[model samples]
Target: MSDLLERLRGRGWRLTSQRRVVAEVLDGDHVHLTADEVHSRAVERLPEISRATVYNTLGELVCLGEVLEVATDGRAKRYDPNAHRPHQHLVCSGCGAIRDVHPQGDPLAGLPQGERFGFVLSGAEITYRGLCPECADRG
Candidate 1:
């Protein structure tokens, strides 16, 4: 996702070496990495990268709308880069694995007009939980 990094650069972001490392760690399809997990990976690349820096960079990325925070349940939040696409998440209840899934229709349509409470809703997030193939087979 050099494109994302380049966009951030064009926006006049600091683009510190630590920020660049975190961005590269999150650069992928269907990658839902938690802040701790991200820090862990970043530490491998640059041992001096502090947790605070990672958290700050992630918050900045989210503010820029380049990253989506996927909180699948009440656990650790995962960072998603598929912000340009409209899709939902399929989470594994057993292993905590996450996948990007495009459902059949508009999920927001399920909210009937009567339940709207007189407010215009623009978007919706739906989380589907189930056992992944590997987890299911283990049982």
Candidate 2:
């Protein structure tokens, strides 16, 4: 069973066949898939699964704080299942691939007191953009 399935079961979330397939499709490291991508994969597992079902399941997962919605390119929002862990993103400039990155120290520490402008800091998202080895090698 995937971590997502375990979490969902622990929370008593109803796991229909369609929902289970959707969750299964999303299980993996550095997995950031858009709704369409998830739907496509879910359909492969369960031929009758509907796109709306996948979208709804994704929305519910996001609402439950079990998944993170990432808007990396301003085109489509990708769903990330690693919501419990604190991390940033490393995006490939050429291929748009995203990887989870854990940098040392507090990210907020980099912002001086005056720079805060009086708002409380909850978290920060720092995305490092560069070409992956595959893209770099292609050049």
Candidate 3:
């Protein structure tokens, strides 16, 4: 992904081998990987890449808006690379699988006017939890 590298370079990020491996590991559709998971994948390509470097690169990506960190169960945050569009998450309560789902209506539309509490709200996060098909069939 030359374009991705160019964008990262434009942001004044150092283009190191470890960073490139980390970015490559994260590129793809519907990829939601934890930091440890990303480190594991990146290590396959660059055997000497450290977990700390992976974490740092991931944090930079999140700050750059190239990725989103999602913590569905208050555990280790998962990094989602689908930052090109606004959307929500659907997580399987059983197996911790995650998917993107579009709800029927604008989710923020239901926020009560009184609930504003004299504060300005910029955004909302909605996570729908349910059993994935495989997990549902297993039960």
Best by TM-score: 2
lDDT of 1 by residue, 1-139 (tens): 3256766777898878999899888887788999999999999999999999999999989999988888866889999877778889999999899999999988889999999999899999888999999999998
lDDT of 3 by residue, 51-120 (tens): 8899989998999887788898777799887776668898999989888766777676779889988767
Residues 84-122, candidate 2, lDDT per residue (tens digit)?
Answer: 888999999898889999999999898999999998999
Span of ten consecutive residues with least summed lDDT in model 2: 1-10
TM-scores, each model vs. reference: 0.89, 0.95, 0.86
Off by over 4 Å in 2: none
Clashes of each: 0, 0, 0
Off-target runs (Cα >4 Å) in candidate 1 are 1-3
Full-model lDDT for every candidate: 0.88, 0.90, 0.82
Worst 10 residues of 3 by lDDT: 1-10
What lDDT, from 0 to 1, does candidate 1 have?
0.88
In angstroms, give how far residue 69 of model 1 lies from its true place.
1.5
